[model samples]
Target: MNHLISRAGLGILVAVAVVAGAWARSGSGSVTAQAVLTGLLLGGVYALVAMGLTLIFGVLDIVNFAHGAFMTLGMYATALLATGAGLNPYLSLLVSVPLLFGLGYAVQRHLVSRTMGGSLAAQLLLTLGIAMLLENALLLAFSGDTRTVAVSFDTPLRVLGAVADLSRVLAFAGAMGLAGAVWLLLTRTRLGTAIRAVAANPEGASLVGLDVRRLHALTFAAGTACAGAAGTLVTPLVTVEPTAGELFNIIGFVVVVLGGLGSVPGAVAGGLIVGLTEQLGGIYLPGQSPLLAVFAVFVLVLLWRPQGLFGRPA
Candidate 1:
């Protein structure tokens, strides 16, 4: 009875907070609901990117600093394919996903693979080099012009007076589905077992007859594919540029750390929490938003829970 009372009290507190905030903002319940949904929808995309980052970092233990660059590459690929080649943005997945996957496989197999168990400098420098190469390559090709893919077909959805573009909503749904699938894969498949095993203990996994090299390639490829999908999903909402991934990469790293190195659920939770916090803080805090707003939380998380919300205890 005591536990139940405590839980009920917490729930009531949260409800009161929500109601008070809504009353302060507009005194409209529908409007508050709208605000909440808006945050949730956008949070989905952030979660998707965080999931991919967690997967790569958690399993392979290689911090692909270039993960965001891959996402940007996907955005660019989809935009170019959609506008230049006259293909649907969604349909461009066929081209973008494979290209990103191939790039990931090649990079890991040739560069990251060689750096395994080597000096930390090698791993860092390799990924850093890849990031630099991608940024420069994009600058040279796109000339710093910001471009966004327009959804030629869209049906706007209005939920409780809050306007949401159909594309963004679809992207949000896709992200959720993909994240769920990833979690399922991580927990319920042979390949997932091998991947997790390799992540936990590479040498032991190999001793048990798992092919470390192949699994590594697959992990790299899968991570890239997640980034690619995220890029494609968000491209319509934002610009496609060379340095676009920089900010995303930073957030991705934070979300992964906050979620716990390789915990998919943790990633999703962290991403949503970060995303909503950013959105709400941006609105309420005035002049302090996004990067700056989340900085405090970032530091607190690191100091209080170094392993992140769900990260394994060190």
Candidate 2:
């Protein structure tokens, strides 16, 4: 009951911030509308990115820092297919998704699984090392060059008197659909039930004959796959560089923290809030980095609800 109230309160607070920001920037209704729409679209991608991080943490309790790198890898893979083989970027998902899934599985099974129940410091170092290795490998392959995937439908669309790229709109729809699928998977599937059981009590789950290690690998793989899909989705919207994922990594962490550490719904809500705060911040502070607004909101939320809006009181 208290959790419900906390969630509602946080929602109200974030909504107020949005309203206040919008009102403050009310000089041009069209610009405000544009920002709001763009922010919501961008937030969908953010939510998808954070969802994977939150899922890994929720089920395996592993802070996988390499998640964004996995995302970058996906972008590169999609780009490669698009540029080299004349394949549609969206169709590359068939390859990128499985590629990331296999890589994530190997990472967890061969490296991360060995560190389970061990030192958190060691786990952090391991994931950090993995991130560095992946980034450097990408640098070697892609050579620090900025790349983009070309799509046939790279045009503009109007919504509510505001103009947005077709790619952004499609990305937004795809992201929301994927997020909903994930939500259903967690709520209405046997695999999800088993995964949740493992999350609740790994030892007890093991005692009950569930293969915890396998589930951990599966969870990590699913998480990375989510990152990969998000990367592919945004390939048209952003430039692809070896270090591109670093910015996303930072944002993912902020979203994960701003949301609950292990809550999927929280991550989604946080992503949208961050996105809105960033876009609106551009209007409120003309010359400042939009992230400044994100941090401000994050700090305010943490100060008010340390465990995050959806996180259980610890």
* Candidate 2 wrong stretches, greater than 4 Å: 1-17
lDDT by residue for model 1 (105-212), tens: 898898889988887777877888999999889999889999878898888898777778899898898889988888888789999999999999999999999999
Regions more than 4 Å wrong, model 1: 1-34
Whole-model lDDT for model 2 versus the true structure?
0.87
- Poorest stretch of ten by lDDT in candidate 1: 277-286
lDDT of 1 at 204: 99
| lDDT to native, each model | 0.82, 0.87
lDDT of 1 at 267: 85
Angstrom error at residue 138, model 2? 1.0
lDDT of 2 at 54: 91
Predicted model with the maximum TM-score? 2
